[model samples]
Target: MRLRAMVHRHHVLGPGRVPALGFLALLATVLLAGCTSQGGAENSLARPLMQGSTAPRAMSPVERLANDLAMADVAFENGDAKALANHLQSVDLAGATPSDANGEAKLNAWRSSIAAAPPAMRGRVLGPAYLSGILAAGSRINTEQVLLGGKAVSIAAGTAPRDTLRLRIVRGDGKIVCEKSPAHARECRFVPTYTQRFRIELYNTGPEDARYHLVFD
Candidate 1:
């Protein structure tokens, strides 16, 4: 997907907190693997846009988790309130609190911000995780655990020649959230870009090449 389109979607979607949480939930399932270097330790889609640097750093597991989690944080701040609330319904508030009062305050603020999200976005918040979870449950798919930076990143295996599978994320009522696209986070199993349409790419990450297509949609 074009970066501009992603920016537009970011705006239209309201509080991105839910999507960010969805991203985190996915990560939780795969947090065993350390980080991988896409560009560098601090590389994120936002960094270059801010500093105008193209240099890539090898991301440590810690850095990748921080970046992904931070991306969700930014999204939550900008997203609608109602969706944020619904999303928070599933979160463990006790777990969110930090030992320090300052940390607790920050967590509380995050919770409040989500509660302030608009009603329209409430149902859409869980779409990404719901869709992905459903896919994981329905298939006898392989899940890989890798460390990126230091955080565990889990990726569901794509058989034979493919290493990735793209999924269209949608609300239970069938609203398009995002499409699977090339711009998705490297560790993401489903890219949220092609909402109404989906394309699954299975890579032969293994040495020997294999081929298969359209056995199932």
Candidate 2:
């Protein structure tokens, strides 16, 4: 029934009515989420929308961090070397600077362990479908950061509210390569063209202001 409804909507929102690009991107995301297996980390994150948008779904600290670490591991195994490389690049930890080699080694070890694991466990080790779905959805929503200078930048979007979003860039041997910002309050369209590993740090510039949630994808 749900499939039928989605198909009908797809047909109704034909090329003439729906723009080919963004709508197709969203549709692809939805399909990917639907097709992925459900359970554990992936299901926990991915099914939030499948279950319903109104209800809140969150992972426990242990679960969330574990998921993140697992993702970082899988990213490395799946030839997503660029993903970690991007994260490292974003951190600007090039050999030019002092750094944490231990952390870099740990990341490498994590990847190595996953790579050595049996093929059957690889997907779960990486993260379930839901995790990928959420990330994919977020990626489609446009995002932009205006470098404020010196490791600081002002993030603006079509609907990003007034707030200072925190950013975190991971590094490998002192270099950044990829980045991701946690979900925020506000809907916007800004695609990040740069490939690097970084995360967002959101803050309310307004004193005593109400909390806001940013939604993309």
Candidate 3:
């Protein structure tokens, strides 16, 4: 199978007194691997845009993550509560202290900012895992089955610090379409041909406990 097209994007939280540099590095390593040459893109349609004098240079994964966090900080400082929430979520606090006093203060502040918003808005702003302090780590397995329906599919997965994650997709014909083993602090994405059934597998191989989230569309 060939990758026809692919896009990589992330929903990250603001850098609120958390050790963000380490997290940014982790995301950068993972997303950058997929961005560069993960799917054998010698003839792939989704190539990186050329940097010309008239065109702005592309931001590397690290730069992009840093920019997102910086923007989130700016939004928070400007009292753009919704914008802040849009950028800051539970994922951003993956390896940090979400139950400590400082963490609780930050969570409460965010909740108060959106307390008057509509119920749906509130739900979206503060995700179900907000302040829950759930961490991903150790060896774990998660399987998901999906129907391709002749449409292109993209799967992106990432783990926290000191975590390694691997993904494999098996087709209805018992064919392995895509596989990725992202070592510690790596993010991965894959695009596979349409198939009747796709069995997606996620594996954690890190010594320390880690958490991961997957985005499939």
Question: Per-residue alpha-carbon lDDT of model 1 for 159-178, expressed as tens digits?
Answer: 22233334233333456433
lDDT of 3 by residue, 45-154 (tens): 45444432365666433223323333444555589877766655433432222424544565456556753532332323321121112234445454555655556555
Instruction: Put the candidates in lDDT order, highest first.
Output: 3, 1, 2
lDDT of each residue in 54-161, candidate 2, tens digit only: 656664322233234334444555667656444323222211111245444644454454334322222222221111111211123222323222342222111122
Q: Top model by lDDT, which number? A: 3
For all predictions, the C-alpha RMSD in Å is 34.1, 27.1, 31.0
The lDDT of model 2 is: 0.36
Better structure of 2 and 3 per TM-score: 3
Each model's backbone clash number: 55, 47, 7
Off by over 4 Å in 2: 1-53, 85-106, 109-217
Would you list the clashing residue pairs of candidate 3? Answer: 13-88, 30-187, 136-210, 136-211, 137-209, 137-210, 138-209
Name the candidate that leads on TM-score: 3
> TM-score for all predictions?
0.20, 0.19, 0.39
Is candidate 1 or 2 superior in TM-score? 1
User: Using alpha carbons, what is the TM-score of model 2?
Assistant: 0.19
